[model samples]
Target: MNSLLPVPPRRHWSTWALLAGLLLLVITSFATLPLKWGDFFSADAVRTTADFLHGFAPPELSPNFLLKVGTATFETLAMSAIGTIIAAVFGALLALPASGRFGKAARQATRGVLNVLRSIPELVWASILLIAAGLGPFAGTLALALHTVGVLGRLFADAFENCPPLPAASLRINGAGPAATFLYATLPQCSPQMLSYTLYRWENNIRAAAILGVVGAGGLGQMLKYHLSLFQMQPAATVIIAMLLMVAAVDGLSYVLRRAMTR
Candidate 1:
């Protein structure tokens, strides 16, 4: 009997070339890293790790320590929430221009500003702000907000640009103004996606807020650093647990909100 199925299409030359190039790049990149494999699993390393880990047993659960951790936890949450809110507002404003709602010159200018803002890591921003604003949650909050604006603005602009043009075009043809077209057509399509991005960034900012505290920005990370510096592993462990719990809670909330949005 003759075979009924058609032959599968062969991979394109460009695909194979791209794969080969990626393989070469990965090999070259791996060769450049200075990895000391001999020390990684050495007996001394194992003993040191075990000893350090031993100290973390029975985390500090004292009333005062718990109270302090609770306060720090709230601070981190507030910083992340406020930073995200400010970034969303500012990012949306910039995104309008970057999305080409404005002319090409405006888009280029807005994008350039976003590139500069997002190029610097949050920690670097925090470090600089610390010098100017003095070490506190304020500096950390600003750092998170600035970096997030870059990220969110870029994402929002892309979302707006990718929105279906048909509805917007129809609105424009019917004498709807640009603002009305955006409000009725462009926004409705992309707002859900923008909200999803904001929530995801908020999750990241929470983790960043915790780390920023290590630089004396005032959060749980500062507490973790202090305890670790004094070799107080139990207290450090408590902080770590608190960080894990906070991250989990945010993740859970994001999941719920995202699910609701999809519906």
Candidate 2:
């Protein structure tokens, strides 16, 4: 009876060909890179890494340095919070048109703008803004806001598009205007999703805020850069530890908020 069962179809040759192509591409990429694999694996490299890591022990616990780290941590948190707020506002505005409530031309134009805003990385945005904002948390804040706006805008538009249409249609049938229908029906359904996306983006912005400081945007990243440049490994390690703690805290908070919303 088992032998009489029909055989499963074999995968097509195209699948195998595509996989082989991908494998070859990977091999070619590794071959073309200028990496010195032998040096990376050498005993001297291992010893050097251990020695360098050893320099960071007993992180600078002095009162003055801890004060500075605390200030920088606050700045990072503020930058991410303010930037996410700004992004949430602008993203929702953009998402309205991008979701096609304003016709095809408006949708296309709005989506194009979103694409442009998001395509430029946060680091690049910070690098450009640093010249104008002049080395502070404000620059980092703006950078986070701009990039996050693009991301949140796209997610919001998708949520709006996928929202259940019956409630909106019923509202319209009962004489609700487009805006009223959206406000009374569509928005209520998708607001939770929008909030979730915003919280997720805020989580990401927190990390970006820290890294933006590397370009002198003013935060823990800036402190880390300064200490590392001067080879102050102990202080740099402290900044790194602060960054980890802050990130972990924000992640937990965002998770709790998202779960609450779902319930």
- What lDDT tens digits, residue by residue, belong to model 1 across residues 123-201? 9999999999998899999999999999999999999999999999999999999999999999999999999999999
lDDT of 2 by residue, 36-144 (tens): 9899999999999999999999899999999999999999999999999999999999999999999999999999999999999999999999889898999989999
The model with the greatest TM-score is: 1
Best by lDDT: 1
Backbone clash pairs for candidate 1 read none
TM-score of 1: 0.94
Candidate 1, superposed: residue stretches over 4 Å from native? 1-10
RMSD of 1: 1.7
What's the lDDT for residue 119 in model 2? 99
